[model samples]
Target: MKRTQARFDVVGQLGALRRYARSLTRDSSDAEDLVQDALLRACENRSSFEAGREVRPWLLSILHNVFVDKTRRSKSESLRIKGLAEMSPKQLDAPQDHSVRLAQIRAAFMKLPEEQRTALHLVTIEGLSYQEAADTLAIPVGTLMSRISRGREALRSFEQGRDQTSLKLVGGRDVS
Candidate 1:
């Protein structure tokens, strides 16, 4: 497939793509594959994101579709392309002191349904507006709002269940 070089910088969206992919797949390695596939598809399908539209949500929408398609294919075939999962970033763990807390939050975050996780990531982590996220997901704005609401409530519940006398969550730049 030929990629007409995008006028906007595609590389600039890498972090958000990776972050959203991680939230979707819940595995950094598979997340990388998802991002790669999405980027490839994005490059191949320039019409997917029209000029003047928010590229981040469009890229994310592509990533989300790729993940959904793969999940469906794997389920039907009864086999996942394990090779993709192995395409890890070779990232080392952060310090235990910080990693532990972040991991806990991540674990809790990951526990949410894929739809909820996706909505939360798009709005909160990626800083997309509700309408933008809704459009990206191809869902109604009301549905997006509901997902974000439920997702936030679940995270709040997760917080309440945790020990109250613990240090606050570590807000590290690295999502993976």
Candidate 2:
């Protein structure tokens, strides 16, 4: 395919890519940066793209790779910032009850392991089929299912104020 056509095809999927990025980063500025980085990488490596394959998944795979790389690089910086923020004074400000609950859920969701979180987001939020999400993540369908299951269980445990071990040991047997 010609360069112009390939760029056009990629641009067509930009909205979906941005949405996926936003889901991954949870910050608009960071998500936009991620999308831009992914697009730049995709354009630079366009030769690797197969002409007959779908573009959205390819773009998504690139976005995921970019996110992983950024996350690895920023791990220490993030920790430092988090530690500094924790050392600061606390505010007594309170949000609305509904907003507070939503914030709690979002915080719990963010606390999930990265793999499980990605799997759940792709399947549930992105409305991707199991096979499609598996393809995007480059994992087996069973592995993807396992991630989603674990992610859901973890979120449930967070809401219920229970640990995963306790949840699995109900009725004098491991239910997991």
Candidate 3:
């Protein structure tokens, strides 16, 4: 019974972790990986999770740290592999007719300034309220709003060619 209750508590937070990971990665595969990593970290540090404190936010904070670490490593490795001068818009925008739309969407997201992308991921994709996202990012609410607006505008303009305009939401909504 104790083990079952522990599993329930962890599984209950899976949706939120998946949402946050999706926002960070913008791809299902990467999101799954991020979630797995976060779960592993949570399990490894279980004793640190204070009793009565919110576990969901604590797990997400760990995820955020993991993302930052991975991003930094990726950036450094990319610089070494591609050479700084070779990493340009043209080079990154290689042709792909079969997956043009997906490529374009990814390219657009990659083009966004990091702050804007983070804001969009947290506020729009993750369905986090502006205040909550701001708290998570440790940014001022005004700055967070500005980043979200810029990110949305950029995504909209980039995907202007597509017939679909509405966001395809997944998971259940917290109506309350």
- Which candidate leads in TM-score? 3
lDDT of 1: 0.82
Task: State TM-scores per candidate.
Answer: 0.41, 0.41, 0.43
User: Could you give the candidate ranking by lDDT, starting with the highest?
Assistant: 2, 1, 3
TM-score of candidate 2 against the unseen true structure:
0.41
State how far residue 94 of model 3 sits from its true place (Å). 28
State the lDDT of candidate 1 residue by residue for 1-176, as single tens digits. 23334645689899999999999999999999999999999889976666667788888889999999999988866544455456755675667878788898998888777888899999999999999999999999999998888778778877788432322322424232
Q: How does each model score on lDDT? A: 0.82, 0.86, 0.80
Instruction: State each candidate's clash count.
Output: 0, 0, 0
Candidate with best lDDT: 2
Residue 98 CA error for candidate 2 (Å)? 57
Q: Candidate 2, 15: how far from true, in Å?
A: 0.8
Q: TM-score rank, highest first?
A: 3, 2, 1
Pull out the clashing pairs in model 2.
none
User: What is the per-residue lDDT of model 3 for residues 53-139, given as tens digits with 9 covering 90 to 100?
Assistant: 777888899999888988999999987878855665554544576488787687777667788888888876799999999999999
Which residue pairs clash in candidate 3?
A: none
